[model samples]
Target: MSTLTPGEQAVMSRFDLGWPESDIAADLSISFARTRAIISTFDSNPAHDRHREAQIRRGSQRLLARLRKAGGHR
Candidate 1:
């Protein structure tokens, strides 16, 4: 799988947290158009669809990894 940029990762993080597109844009300091484009690109990517299905079965391990990276305890 291709690596996501930090901005893309931030967008996905907020999206998974149930934040709206506008809110994500505002919170991340990204333009709404760019945020929407990232979301649209992710939605259209077949790999992301497969990843989502896998995550649904396995739970959100990736979020845990992010937390760990940010110094959260395991």
Candidate 2:
């Protein structure tokens, strides 16, 4: 996939990293309410959905690897 736009990447990464809306707003030099709306947009976007799914897959793979290293099974 192509690289994300600065705004798209920032919003997605901030939300993915579990940042507070206020922090995202302050960092992006935007207002708190505008940040909230941006978060809402990110939540419903298909492009962001693809990023979220990739993250989930990577996380699950890492968890499985760690479990395997510990000789654990599901």
User: What is the per-residue lDDT of model 2 for residues 6-56, given as tens digits with 9 covering 90 to 100?
Assistant: 876787689788899889888988788877766665576788678778988
Q: Model 1 over residues 1-74: C-alpha lDDT tens digits?
A: 68899989999888878899999999989899999879866755788778768866566677777788899855
Residue 67 CA error for candidate 2 (Å)? 61
> Model 1, residue 34: displacement in angstroms?
0.2
Tally clashes: model 1: 0
* lDDT scores of the candidates, listed in order: 0.83, 0.80
TM-score for all predictions? 0.56, 0.47
Cα miss at 46, model 2 (Å)? 13
Candidate 1 segments whose C-alpha is farther than 4 A from its true place: 44-74
Best candidate according to TM-score: 1
The CA lDDT at 39 in model 2 is 69
